[model samples]
Target: MAKYLLLKHYRGAPAAVNDVPMDRWTPEELAAHVRYMNDFAARLEETGELVEHQALRPEGTFVRGDGEGRPPVTDGPFAETKDLIAGWTVIDVDSYERALELAGELSAAPGAGGEPINEWLEVRPFLTCLPTVIE
Candidate 1:
């Protein structure tokens, strides 16, 4: 089995086919979108393919470690960020092909006008930790 991360981006990705931003979507449309995502997750969990999933708020902060004596430096939710990840899903599947197929299914979540979002999702595989060897 292999593990994969399905990254959903709020920005810094190609324009979606739906084009309408979530904030612009009507209340009912927003509910439908959320419901669809929840249902998808549920189905995956039942199939034992889901590891975990979460959605993120847009607000964020950046912090960096300072010298030992000093506290960490805190910074803004930069307007210049190249990418803002919206959320992520971790899935354990049999193969990369299955991961790709799941991502494609997720990309079809309903959007405005009750249509498929047809959004692009970034799929990444978890690096395997090799066993240590002793001479």
Candidate 2:
């Protein structure tokens, strides 16, 4: 089976069909959205397609290694960055078509007004190591 990553972005994507910001959504709407995602994951898990899923906090720190014997450098939470990832799901499927279909369905998760967000999800395929050629 091939593995694919479904990236859910908080920004840096085109506006969703619903277009309403999550901060503007009502509490009930937020609950419903969470429920939809959970239900979707459960179904995928039952099918053995879901490998793992997780949600992330909106903020994150950027860390990089300094030269040896130096402390690692840390940057701000990147609030000003154009792209912010909100969550991710890894799926193992038989074909790319299946992966795309699943991503489309996930992008349909409910948003404000109890409507489909119709957002875009970034699909990335896992790379396999090439066979080594020995002389």
Candidate 3:
């Protein structure tokens, strides 16, 4: 099985059909969206395809080592100035097509008015370290 990453972007993506921000969504709609995401992950686990998933906080900083004896330099969260990644899921699937199918299902997650969001997801394959043997 190959591993693929499904990336959900908060910015730097095409506007979604249901483009209302999560903060603007009604409480009920937010709850339903959360439930749908959880259920999707659970279903993937049941199918033995889920490797891991995570949600990131909007606030983050960029840090760099200044020097061997100096403190690291820190920068602003800069969410407005940069494209923010909201979350991701790693899946081990039998084929690339399977990964695409799973990503499509995830992109169909419910949004406001209990309608499909039609969100865009970036799918990328992981490079394996295993050596290939040429016949």
Candidate 4:
């Protein structure tokens, strides 16, 4: 099965949304959301399709090489970047269509009021090199 990456891109600015993002959500709503994701992941696991899944921290540093002796310079999380990725999930599927279907299901993750967040996800296939990618 080919692997795909389901990227989570946050649309709004973190600061502008509220002083606290998830904290702003009601306790019941948050629990429901968590349950939804848990159920979704469980379903995928039962299908033997989920290879691995994880969430990532938003903060990151970009390093640029200067010289052999000089240490690489670092940059921060750009506040102005429009499409800031919150996290990602990896799954193994048979084809691109199947990957898309999985991505669709993930996008339907529960939002407030038990409605689908309908979040945008970037679905990209993993590049395999075992069989000579160049050939």
Error of 3 at 44 (Å): 0.4
Of the candidates numbered 1 and 4, which has the greater TM-score value?
Answer: 1
In angstroms, how far off is 30's CA in candidate 2?
Answer: 1.9
Q: What is the lDDT of candidate 4?
A: 0.77
Best by TM-score: 3
Tens-place lDDT digits, model 4, residues 1-135: 899999876544233212235656788878988898889889889998887777777676778999999999988767756456777788998889999999988877766666677666789889886875696
17 Cα displacement, candidate 1 (Å): 0.7
Off by more than 4 A, model 3: none
TM-score of 3: 0.93
Residue lDDT tens for model 2, 46-120: 999999999998887889999999999998876757599999999999999999999999999888998999998
Q: Can you write out model 1's per-residue Cα lDDT over 18-98, one digit (the tens) per residue?
A: 878888888999999999899999999999999999999988888999999999999888875658899999999999999
Per-residue C-alpha lDDT of model 3 across residues 1-135, encoded as one tens digit per residue? 999999999887788887777778889999999999999999999999999999998788999999999999999888577888999999999999999999999998988788889889999999998867885
What is the Cα-based lDDT of residue 23 in candidate 2? 95
Pairs of residues clashing in candidate 3 = none
Ten consecutive residues with minimal summed lDDT in candidate 4?
11-20
Assess each prediction's global lDDT (C-alpha) against the native. 0.91, 0.91, 0.92, 0.77
Better of 1 and 2 by TM-score: 1
